[model samples]
Target chain A: MPNRARFIVQIILLFLITLHARPPAAHEAPPSVRAELPLLTAPAISREGYFTLQLQSLPTVPLVVEYSTDPQFTQVTAQYPWFADFSQMTLSGFPNGQHYFRLAQAGVDGSAPNQVGPVVMVRVQHYPLNLAIGLLCFGGAMFGLLVVMIVRGHWSRSRYE
Target chain B: MSEPISYALPTSLGVALIIAFGILWIFYGWYLGRKNQTHDDFALAGRQVGLALAMATAMATWVTSNTTLVAPQLAYQLGIWGMVGYSFAALGLILFAPLAARIKQLMPMGYTSGDFIRLRFGRAAWWPFIVISLIYALGWLVSLGMAGGILLQALTGLDYHIGMSVILFICVGYTLFGGLRAVIATDFIQTVVIIIGVVVTAWFLIDKVSLASIHQNLSDNHPKLLDLLFPAALMFLFNNIFFGLGEIFHSNVWWSRAQAFRKGIAFKAFLIGGLLWLPIPIVTGFIALAAPQLGIYPPSADMIGPMVTAQVLGKVGAVIVLVVVFSALASSLDSLLAATSDLITRDIYCQFFNPEANDQQLIRWNRLCLIGLGVFTWLLCLPQVATLAALLHFTGAFVASTIFPIVLGLYHPKLSGRTATLAMIAGSTLGLISYFVVGFYVAALTSSVVSMLVCVLGLRWSTTSFRWQQLQESDGC
Candidate 1:
């Protein structure tokens, strides 16, 4: 029991090098909330397919907008806006399927993360082929069983002689 | 020194150790070849394998290249459940004990499970069974070959092609010379090394990183990783159980081991192996919590477990990780060699090519086939391009997807071999579609279900029912 307890403790301390990769403990401040800031108070869009993103920030605090199909930070928009009407903003720039958007509230002093929102998982539906051959297999089995039965019965009848 | 236990080995030393170990492993075969006893000595060690060794080999083989490489990949990204899902698959072996015992009773002197398929089902079914086993054997060879290459790239600075070719060539050389003796003896040694290495890494890692810390860190930063009740996690676990059960039940690898055992040992080994194997993936996966915090993102699924070891423990730590992986890779590769060679020699050669061949002639042919298969896989492994998991999963899916035919064929003697074959053809093709259409994980489940349905329905149409007790004692040819 003591060894098991010691074993458990040692593992935790080793894993402590990267805390956020796991769930937050009772005492720890959630990293999600630590990322919150006033200058970059961008309203996170809830439903990714069709939802308006609202931005709330000081006029002096210029916000840079970005969107991407991936959760990664490769998609930054050139256009700056105090408040860009997302209805006019082209959603077409984003890929056809689910995407992520990040808004940065920035001052000239520093461009650090004011805040980050939830990571969204989206499934895109594209119609194509799936398991159709599986259906064909069912058809084939019926045919084979039919023949096996025919042969088995003939063999049985001959054996009766 | 203050790092995690998994990080104790250096990367350079790790790679060198793996290469050194492979060279040493061949000698076991060379030795086995010198003792040219009867078929008993070659195939089953005259039924002399100890409980401990038997237990270890059974567990080691079931663990597979996938257990070390693929399980952690799924665990890291798909979250904890991916690892859990795989670990849960061990239940398949446990459930299969009854079947194993029945087989032992049916074929006390069986050479391979192919024997059971041949005698009860007759020649009409033998060819179809052979074809299924053929696809499985060759496909397994290629996947393990691919795994060896990936392990090389991870452990050493070696190119994928070189690493893979080296491993395959070495495995083939010994397997051709030694037959089942080489495979099982080496499996025993590999199992010992693997246990020591894995137990140390997992134990040390667990001691270093507490369960409490993992829960705390994941909840605070990446809550997704800690969600044990995640929906995908739930589906993944159940689907994997069925997938695993069907695969182990139907395949010649387990079948050959069962045939090689004393009448009772096969069942005992499987039950014990299943229990022992249940914890390995979970222990290794807990290390992945360091991925995000350490800024170590795995390039591919196969790299996650070792990469984490390096990030947390540094170069020396990574080397210990390498030794564990080497053990896993060898254990799985040797099983593929022995089982595939058995399939070719017994099913195709003796049954179809030359039925008049004596035991001595056929045993010689088995050794030759072992060499041929080894060479074939070695050549295939020379060009390494695909991710480790993809190579195995896709190929494994090709064979694993056919589990339905073997299972249904065995239990319900009325099921037409035609139905089993066609269902397999259907299952494999459709399984490929599912892999591309949905995802790799779901494809396995879909194929099993599709094949089972065809088997069940086809049996209903047959006029004669099967008697379970009438099974044959003859195995192979």
Candidate 2:
């Protein structure tokens, strides 16, 4: 009974040690959170369709987004207001072309913007016909082989039987 | 690790489900255990499994963690070609139909795949073959174990170790009581549950987000997903075939099932099972495509399937995903435990350790092996080191090297045992080098090609007539 108690104590200590050893969770804020500004991430070259835009920041902080086809900030095609929980958006009906987007911190106090993220580009292009043909040929060949193997097996078994 | 995400289901409900199903399965397996009177009865279920049960078990066992999580993951990562490439794995089962028939005819009294290897290729080849089989089995067991923990933590706020431990215990308890009989019987019911859960989830998802809108969304936003010529996905398509073929062709799991089915049932069971399994990945893969539409960006790709279901369908969808994944994990875990322990019991224990061990002694040791293996796997799964896809594919080089040797050793007489051993060693070495040098996608492909070259050369150089009658010799004490 005494030995059993010792074993239990050891196990508890081990568990606590391991738990303490683990790194902080991904969403936890480090000491340097005040130093590094949050950024927006998107694909460099996306296909012509709906795509997602992800915002990397503390979950508590709100951000606003602006997108446009023009490289310059003369025209703002879309705008999203300050939202905290919703960090991702799916934009659709993007014609085959290049588009630029940027994000700015929603001013907590009524004043000038604190920080503006760099502009990122997303290119939407049509599907390649050659790649499609290649996929078709490979798929067709695989199907044909499956058929041939099945038939040959049946035929061989019949002859042997 | 990220902050352990929580789903809608309460912890109490998850615990209750696990306990209730665990008890029910144990009782069912024990009831089936009443009929066992001999070693063969326990190990091979008396070799009289009918068509329906056989087909159900085959399909259920093959729809593993890879299909549930990795299928969606690939789709999310590689787009349209990912799920389509995954569906190609069903061909392994389809192609094995003829091979299963041949196996049964060649060795009617065979106990395990190891028995065949030992008989066909003397000690020279059997050693390397056993090592390869053990590595692949453990690789698969650990993958399933990790998936269980990950699935539970994602659904409820259950601790990873607790969830993983409970699942391993439940599967081990039932498998220990019933042997292969319990495994197959539970598999039939589990198959029904899985099919229903997936179909309902997909139905609700499609109804919520129409396919037309998804197409337009992808066409406008992520065109590479629909591109006919996706480079990496294309390479993945061809490479995935070799992985599946190696998994089914060499593993003792399928070999034991092939030996268990009733006369003339193995071939048809595999064929039907393959056809049923082909469409499942496609449907599951389609769910991943809806991620962009649903605005889901998961921390890890493996969680996309469950996260999408939970978000779109709410608590009810989370419960469905939980049940399907649990059932899938249990089916494959139980089979691997049964089949791998059988190999150790029959091949190593009886064939080597105790040649005079009787049927009853063999049964006792088999149970012991299961308990020991369950404990070992639980320890390994405690540390979530790698993702599901990465872990499963890492052993591709090891398993793929055995494909050619197994196929040739079964049918071709010209290939000598010495040559087979050399081929396996050389093939696996080159394959592993390529795995590190080239990429994960090419590991199996490179291994199979190298193994095939050595085998063809061996056949041309050697002349040894392996008599078919020798395969039926009773070497299992």
The local lDDT score (0 to 100) that residue B165 gets in candidate 1 is 65
lDDT of 1 by residue, B1-477 (tens): 011112223333444565566557766787886775765666555666666767777888877777877777667655777777778778767756656665665566666666676666666656555676666666667777877766655544345565676677667767766767777887887777777877777767666666676666556544555665444444445445555765677677787777666655766888899998899877676676555444343435566677667556656566766667767877787787777776777677877788777767877887887788877877766665565555555644455545655555544567665676666666667767877886555566666666767777877787766565656544334
TM-score of chain A of each: 0.29, 0.49
Report how far residue B308 has shifted in candidate 1, in Å: 1.3
> Candidate 2 lDDT, tens digit per residue, A1-161?
69967964674454334322222132233232223445778877654333557767643444556678898867866554432243454454355688888876545443434666788788866445465456445645644654464456556655876
Residue by residue across B1-477, what tens digits does model 2's lDDT show? 111123556655665666567668877888998887877888899999999999999999999998998898788766788889999999889888888888998888788888888888887788988998999988899999988877766656566677787788879988998899889989999999999999999899988988998787677555667764666567667668878888998888999999999989999999999999998888878898887666555545676788788878988898889889889989999999999999999889998899999889999999999999999998888887877887887788888888778777766667788888888888788878977886666677778777877888988988777887889888759
Superposed Cα RMSD, model 2: 6.3
**Best prediction by lDDT:** 2
lDDT of 2 at B146: 85
- Cα lDDT, all candidates: 0.59, 0.77
lDDT of 1 by residue, A83-145 (tens): 211111111111125545555443334444454344333333221223323433442453355
User: In model 1, which regions exceed 4 Å deviation?
Assistant: A1-161, B1-15, B210-222, B229-232, B396-405, B408-419, B466-477
Q: Which ten residues in a row have the lowest lDDT in candidate 2 chain B?
A: B1-10
